[model samples]
Target: MIKSGISQIGGKYRLKNILIDNTPYHEYFLSLFCGSCVYELNKKKANHYECFNDKNPEIANYFIVIKKFFKEFEERRKKGPYTIISRYLYDLLNAGILTPDDMIEQAIQFHYKIKLSFASQLKFRGLIPETTSKKQFITQAKKDFKEAAKNRNRTEGHFKNSLGKTTRPISNNDCGILTPLNPKLEKRLKYVIIEALDFRDLYNRFYRSYYIKKGLTKEVFIYADEPYPGTEKYYGNLFKPEDHQDLIEICLNSPFNIMLSTGGECGIYLDALGDAGWFIKEVYTRYSTNANNQNLTKEYICMNYDIGKVHKMVMDNQPNIMNYVEG
Candidate 1:
């Protein structure tokens, strides 16, 4: 469980909440980047635009306006698709039905659509826009997609080199190398680790370290070729909503306390954990540099036991613990 006040709206710990809510979807489009940043920065309660000004005012303003502009564009586009909107706005400007500023806004909206469509096409195959009138845009989109696909394939080939000849999906029983726990936790946790590795290599490393610390053996690992839903398949399988739901159910039903690592991956898991009524306590990571360090490295644990009491204790006795974990 997380400590008391850890989830408060201000301070270093606040970004965790932002990451949990925005990362999977917000990272794809540039316009929504500021909203994601604002949420992570704990400025969601205040004016979304103001959050950006607290650090980089100019960039923040740009993002804020972009977000607003996109919202309006979306509303207007509901009457038609981007091509129709572009034509109508252009005609409106030519006929004096729209002002100069309106024309510019419409153009910006069109530009945003072009950029977004091009990026999406490049990221995923079979995404070519059907109504883009500009041949240049289509050409560019195709080129970009091919290049991106090439790069992604290259990266995947490299990662695949690291895994041995275990081509089939790993079964729960084959994951005995993971930390031993209640049978329920063991089955579910192993699957989580395996599924996470399908998205992030670093997550696999973290899980490996976690199991080692718990005195579990290592097992053969595998990655699913297809992307998980709600995320681009390019980076491997995206973390799905159902994945989170499963995790929360497992954690809530568990007999022992749950521990989570800190980072984007863990943040995703915490969303479900929060929904399931688990709170976080202290966050710890094994250190390798300190002389007293147990030489254990690549492990993080967020203890969920007595989260409220532990949080209060840390707040009173060690207010700096937040800084420690935040850093």
Candidate 2:
């Protein structure tokens, strides 16, 4: 499971409560960062000091402070950036100052303020890497900051669109299922699942047809395979099973009920959920009979199913069972 917390390094005040309660955009940003932090911390055993050695000590210390801060808020992990923000808003609603209606707009403004403040702090502390004659660290920082601003704007736009509309809270029973709020947006919910190795084209296709067009219903879900590690030279040793877990949680919790998984790789998580009595539905992508093969027919079999349906398929198509992934 992923951990959560609040920072003690930064003082907690009424403003923090108001900011968290009122701002939807900031909530989204913080949730994304929390997911990313979970991926990093779980994947690497090293402390922040060791992992961020390239950064200034003060900058690294700030990250340590952040890590500690979020550690206090670990129990409430929700899906999607919006839902994550909503979780914080819900907490603020308990504090008796802000109404649920005020959250989305407040969260957006707070998110922008946090980003700007953090960036300024980094610059003020000289923690942002100094530019060299050959390498332009300052230029890279500027580009990254611009990108961050752009993404924040996009999130803010989405949050603004949610105002004046009431969103029904999703229940635990609706976990794996998609529920449409608007009938007109239903078509955007159809999704195609592909191996992470085959993700390039599929990602482009999904973004162009669904995400970019803004045609997606709140219910449409994408189930993507996790990418294979070591595909990039710089990231060779950086990938880990936990990183995939973080990615899976992010997708599972998104505005659209999209899901991404490397089916086999996610077995650990699935098994854990199953042990917790969560209902798991197994969908077979392919099949092969060879028992010794890593990707085999039996492995794809549903744990919840008895011998009836699967046995019938196996008996009817013996040849199909031999069509395992090529070694």
Which one is best on lDDT?
1
Model 2: lowest-lDDT 10 consecutive positions:
23-32
Give the alpha carbon lDDT tens digit for every residue of 217-303 in model 2: 332333322332222222233345446555544443344332222244456556544564433444433322121222321111112
How close is each model in CA RMSD to the real structure?
23.8, 24.1
- TM-score (C-alpha, index-matched) for candidate 1: 0.21
Give the TM-score comparing model 2 with the true structure, all chains together.
0.21
Off by over 4 Å in 2: 1-216, 227-239, 259-261, 271-279, 283-327
lDDT of 1 by residue, 123-226 (tens): 11112334334345557756755554444434545533222343332222211112121222122112111111222343334344534454332121111112
lDDT value, residue 116 of candidate 2: 23
Off by over 4 Å in 1: 1-205, 212-237, 249-303, 311-327
